[model samples]
Target: MQELQQHLEATEQRLDAFLVKLTQRAQELLNGFEQEAVNIRRNDTIYGQAYSRFLAATRGQVQKLREKVKEVEETQIMPVFYRHCTQSSLAGFSSMVYEWRNRCQAKILQWEEQLYASESAAIERAEWQDYETVFQSHLQQYHAEKEKVYCKQCGAKLAINQVYYYTVYITCTFCQTQNIFNPGTSARQLEDTARKLAEQRSRPVLEQQQFYQQRERDLYMQAHELQLSLIHEKNNQIIKEKQQAIARLEEQRQEAVVKAPQLMEEYHRSVFDELNNLLPDLREHHEKFYRAITTHYQ
Candidate 1:
């Protein structure tokens, strides 16, 4: 019983060390995820070039982490578990080892569970919703600010939502002179951007101006609603699918955790099998080494 207890404690210590290594690698994976989050902002029109490189680097790191985990599992964890599970030891100790192996398996399962939960927290739906809701509200304020404008020509007071381009010409009813209005500073740079010339320079340019004003209002409404409309669509959209990418990355982390032990055990056992295959040939060499050492005493 005492011998069995010692073996059981030794097994636990081995598993504990493996767990510590697993925890450290899992933290590295989490840090990579956080770094990606910082690089990719929600409102970016395109993924930053640096972030594109980061994704590739992150995959390499995750693959390396998996390899390390496999090494630990095969080299440290499986030997302990197999030693207890096989019951080649004292008759009473087999039962104790069986219990110890089961306990070790439980610890492995718990490690995977904790890792999955940690990764999932990074891409959780509720948190994504919160991030977008705040951004959408801020975007709303931005739209409201852009909508406050008036016609510089007639001072006729354009609608709250006017789509002023680079340069537009308007005629005042009170005065009959053409007034060139540049609603925004960039109008001079992109002066020819508009397809129509202030309603094609028609006599009733005021009505044309009103038409353009209404068109701008419609566009503004669309832009504002769309920003808030498809948080889910944005997740799946081919161009800026940040949310989906993050979710996929989280799944990869979870997969690594779940597969770590099983993969290690399979590979670890194979390594031992290879050693066993060479053992018969090695026995002659082993004896020669022993005899060589014993000859020194003679």
Candidate 2:
């Protein structure tokens, strides 16, 4: 019993020390990845290369740590605990080993999630900035030509107050004719550009909203999966009760799913609101475009 106790104590201490070292190593890997991220543009091919390497390296480290935990559990901890199975105190040592394994696994999962989120956010921001640059260029071109609209009815130049995406009836100063001005495809495309820019800007908020919506879906799927597994059982009465429980879960899921469109509606409103703010001069066009798209949702 004394020797078993000594072995358990030594194993626990060694495992604890291993966990500390694993954590340090993981942090070191993360630090290196972050340093690479600082130098690489998210849109560049190099960014993907760096990310793949980082992911592989981190996953390898995690796998190694997991294998070490399992090794210790099977070869050292379990053997010692089983040899002294009659000793009740040895059960606590077994529990300690299990807890350590769970903790380590949990930490690894958390680190991976954090890394993924960081990468996603970085990519999103980079795309947003790229769109912003394009929008600014379009804006500059729009302003420079705002007063350059020539009256098709007469040779007179029309001093337009704002950018028009669609056909506008502008009274000619010289001919006094209502010249139907269509700003052509290039100008019409600016509305699309503005809309895309706004969407990119609000992507993070949309993603957050989508995350909860996805979570609800995942919960429903998990419950449905459980219900399917239970259906395979031989018991009839228990299956009936389980089916009823799953039905309730499905009902709840339906309720949540019904609310999903409203969330999308909110996101759309937010995107257009942002669009209007970005190009307040085109508010009328933006509102018309918003109404045109949202009518289907309604």
Candidate 3:
């Protein structure tokens, strides 16, 4: 009986050692998941705030520009006496309006740059958060499995408070008999569990590869679907951006539509007025202005 007790004690010691290793490993994996989740959440919060700011500012500016364009169209018209009124005050007012419009358009361009940068950053950060969630879910499953204790004999499973240990030594949880799991016992039961875990670890890389390969195939089919919805969200943002750009361009074109004929008429009148000997200099200056404006519009 004493010898049996000694064997039981030794077996219990080994089991304790094994459990400690498993628990530590499981905790390490859980810690990694938790840390990654925290980082992802932090990144998401920052990106979300920046994106919201970009959207708000851009929307407000575009709306203001649209309102200004409407007001200008309603309140001002190209005067027939524009050529006759070459006074310094008139030139200064015209210069001020031009400068204001140019400044507003420049601001719109700056906001466009900010929107593009913020949207791209948000997309990348969102993807990272999604990946982190997947990792934590898998880690949760592994930790749950690690909490189960297995029988030393017949490879049966054991649970907390499910079976009592015999003699405080190595004994089968199922059979309640010593020597059943003595040396030479098959490791097949634990081997299967370890194999499953190993397979779990490899799943993420496999999924990522599959995602890339399958992306082209399902693009059209899933465009209307909502499962992989974030991609569609990014696409919608791109479409909205393009539409805003088109509206701005159209507004500028309409403004030019009114100004073009007037500019040509004024050019003819100016040439007639200053035809003495400055024609060459005026033409050269006009050509330069045309080139610069054309470059800007393009």
Candidate 4:
């Protein structure tokens, strides 16, 4: 029993040392990626390509770290405990493993948020701004050119009072002729641009929604961990306590789940509010799209 305790202690120390090394390696990778990202010009054509490569590399490195942790746990850490301890005695070691793995995974998630999320958002915003410039230029030209359209049959000048995304029939006041008016491709494409711009503006609300989503995930993980503990707990009292804890965690998870829809509703309302403001003429279309999205979520 003493030898087994010594083995368990040694194994834990080894895991701790291994985790530190892995963390160091992960930090180095993040530092290198950040340096590379800082050097890449946002306006460069290859900027997106470089970012994609960096993301893939970072994910690969994280995967390797995960595999290393699993390898060490299986080959060095758990085997000794499993061989020397009964099922109930193994529970503590399993919890330790769980904690170490969680820490490693959490570190990876932290690195991803620190190194990627903001940079990705910035890149998206920059790209959107570039598109917005072109879209505004074309919209201006379209509006200026479409102010007056002459009837083909009677050569009477007809006034275009509103922007049309698609083809329309304008009845000439002079000859009562139906003149076909096409807004052209650029004007039609404005619908897509308008939606994109609105979404870009509402990104902050979307991020808030994502935060609630992550909270739900974390609660679920906590509940699952407690369930595992319950499975391994031999003492009736401890098992009952774990079950109660799991119940509380499950309640919290349900509450978190409820918040997701509420937050999503907020995001949807915000997006369409911006959409309606940007293209008041297309409110009907926006409302239809919003209804479809909200219905799907429900």
Of the candidates shown, which would achieve the greatest lDDT relative to the real structure? 4
Q: Which regions of candidate 4 are displaced past 4 Å? A: 1-139, 154-156, 235-237
Sequence-dependent TM-score of model 1: 0.37
What candidate 1 gets wrong by more than 4 Å, as runs, is 42-67, 81-89, 124-298
Residue 203 C-alpha lDDT in model 3: 47
Candidate 2 vs. true structure, TM-score: 0.48
Q: Candidate 1, overall lDDT? A: 0.49
lDDT string, candidate 1, 1-298, tens digits: 6865786688678768877887788777777677655646443456356555655565566556556655766676678667656765565455555556555655665566566556655433212333224333543543454445445655564443333433566554555556665556333212221112211222143334344443443444344334333332534564355445545545554554444444434433343333223233333433564456445533
Local distance difference test, per candidate?
A: 0.49, 0.66, 0.41, 0.70
What is candidate 3's lDDT per residue for 24-82, written digit by digit as tens? 54344434444454455456667466545544554454445445433433343122123
Clashing residue pair totals per candidate (backbone < 3 A): 1, 0, 1, 0
Where in model 3 is the C-alpha error above 4 Å?
1-88, 91-96, 119-123, 126-298
lDDT by residue for model 2 over 1-298, one digit each (tens)? 3665466567667766765676577556656655555555464575367656655665566567557656765786556545665456666455444444444444444444544555455444433446788787887777666567787767788867777777889888788878777777656557778889888877777776677676666557557555545634778888887788888877777766876676778888989999898878888877888898899778
* Per-residue lDDT of model 4, residues 76-174, tens digit only: 755654554446766556655454445444544544444444445444543445546755776687777687679999998877776678888999888
Candidate 3 achieves a global lDDT of: 0.41
- In model 2, where is the ten-residue run with the lowest total lDDT? 95-104
User: For candidate 4, what is the TM-score?
Assistant: 0.60
